[model samples]
Target: MPVTRANAMSKENKKVAVIGAGIIGMAVASCLQRDGHDIFVVDPNEPGLGASFGNAGVFGTSSVAPMSMPGAIRQVPKWLSDPYGPLAVRWSYLPFIAGWLARYIAAGRPDRVERQARALRDMLGRAVDNLAPLVEAAEATAVFHRNGSLFIYRSAEGFAKDRQTWDLRARNGVQWEELDAAALRQFEPSLSSNCTYGILVRTNGHTSNPHALVTCLAQNLIKRGATIHRTAAIGFVLDGDRLRAIRTTQGEIPVDAAVVAAGAFSRPLSRQLGDRLPLETERGYHIMISDPEVRPKVPIADQEAKFVATPMDTGLRLAGTVELAGLNAPPNWERSRILLHQARGLFPALRDNYPEDRLSLWMGHRPSLPDSLPVIDRSKRSPDVFYAFGHGHVGMASSGMTGMVLADLIAGRRPTIDITPFRANRFA
Candidate 1:
């Protein structure tokens, strides 16, 4: 790949068009604007109100774990049948979802797992150092906080099973401390007596409000004079490897540079530009406790149900579950209800966690690749197009660093990490 003199000059003086105003999109927009590029952000909903809104708000830079692990593939059957189970897969759709499942299962192989782990560590290691400053630079210090996270297992069997993974975690430089039942009680007195074993990773962090962070980044982008338009991006105007303009619901916004950070919706948009990426949506639900008294000192991921409780500005946010349904499907509010139900299981006193789904509930589909890695490379099909989607469950964890990474690429500077591992055509 060669850096173009024209792109260098244009990036320094010409305009850029960014599709999606989600955290990933806005974060990239801010970075580009700061590095001296005019930007325009387009989205159908209000900026950040899509998948970026209502995230568990955890800054999980220390979390380098892959979604597919050694034992996860076997649990799909039981999970698919149970409503309140940790994960529920709709059995009827298994045929179509099987490709995703098969790919994920292949990732569970030791070699693949190890490789994916390294890639995740590369992204996460850069996230904390990169994201904190951006949060400050964007003037939203409240959005970034390092309170850490706790992973609690109710049974000794569960605790024993994961001890081996700690070695891999340690290899990635993530520090965690194990705690027995008594130690768990000592750490969080309010925790249910059933939480018998746990590990506390202090390197983790959380957001006060994910939506606030997204909006603040967009505001900063606007403050820097980036034009943000609300429109549905239909396609691209291509001239060889360069994208000439963006085809939107409103009109063709002539674009010298274009990036696809449209969350789960990135697939359709990317395909329209002649790029095919195996991106799937894992719809995660969050239930916020508006009652002021409800709170968790740090974000905690439940051992079984995959839910996590994070202390947000609103209150305590309990989010979890992965539904593989595609876009436009109504979120199963039943799943959100289950989050509320299990959150109470974590804390005995849950009188105020939000009375109904109308208040505390929110759902968003996180874009994920089967191997649990992100697409962070320039498109081979369109030299003017770049991909920054498929951060999967780690979007909140990796969004800001992704911005700097994108900035470095657009600026024609070598990235700090070997980006070849995240190439867009690796699936080939």
Candidate 2:
């Protein structure tokens, strides 16, 4: 039998430590536990309160387009000049991030962008299917629905300008339906008449509550005999090429194998493991209304405005934006306010006089790599240490598949996809 196949049937289970309790970590812990491995998760903050909490709630499997495209570099100057634009990088922090910015722009090369898109599509194409079993096992199916997603454009010209993106999506085998103004309005009556063109991805879907799903997954892992330590992972203890234990604020916990899915904080840990990844944070903002007057049957994205409005169980969530200010800088709440204004423009029926108590404003860091792909490979320094972070905007959509692939790597099995693109040594 193959080494991985032998391990699968060994009957000797190993203790695996997952160093994060967000959606990614919880998902990985759940997968490893199901495979009969002893699982332990460690994190300083409460699980599900990070980026996993404030996401747009859309599981965009068909969203395989990379943010870095042929013309993206030229748009950066204008985007940075406009404070309220969809993408912005602080001028003061430019000098500090100059190196990463250069690489980010370089990834926009035509050939590179296409390669990134294909890799992302391969990993996220089966997002809903990959997550279904886990969602059902956790009894959280109510949160996720395959109602598909809608992208509305302000005009035919605007939609025409995005033909390149649509073409790329088509090349990746993404299914969709184009709707005229009348059909679009009938499909999502909540959308204002200003949105004249609509394209609905028939295979896409979203969650009504992202935080609830994360909580459900975490709870399910705990119920399945997995231990969760509410402590910060400070470092790791390695014995030669193998990891002996993970050092945390509470204490050192021994482990036979480990996964670092700490989101934006995975950079320092990666550096400690001898691979200096160019991991940066895209601080994303969201505004949630507790009781909305109007609700969309499915999630809708204003293609021109660069924001999404997803009808959640509690209310409608308006979320999007890419702000680069590193990890320690304070959030600019104005960005969240801007999202509210843009959302109102898209949906005119939203009452301006809604109670202030019904609103929730949030900002969280999204771990990202320049190439717009995550590191789902093993650490170059430690044989037993694996990496699974830098997912950018697709973290939620890709979490299930990421967990499955990482589990296979941990079990010494060849993953179903080519993970070479996500290797830690890529940056090196």
Which model scores highest in TM-score? 2
Per-residue lDDT over 1-428 for candidate 1, one digit per residue giving the tens place of the 0 to 100 score = 11122344444565778888988998888888888887878888889887789788777766677889888777777987787876766556567778877888888888888888888888887576678777887899866787678998987788777765767777888888888999988888878898898889888888888899998888888887777887888888888878888888877887788888898988888887667888888888887767545566788888766789888787778887888777667878888888877877788877634546435778898898998888988876787788899988889888877888888888888987777767888887
Candidate 1: where is the Cα deviation over 4 Å? 1-11, 351-354, 357-359
Model 2 C-alpha lDDT per residue in residues 350-385, reported as the tens digit of each score: 866566699888999999899899999888888889
TM-score of each: 0.93, 0.96
Off by over 4 Å in 2: 1-12
Number of the predicted model whose lDDT against the real structure is largest: 2
Clashes counted in candidate 1 amount to: 3
Worst 10 residues of 1 by lDDT: 1-10
Candidates in order have lDDT scores of 0.80, 0.86
Q: Candidate 2 at 385: error in angstroms?
A: 0.3
TM-score of predicted structure 2: 0.96
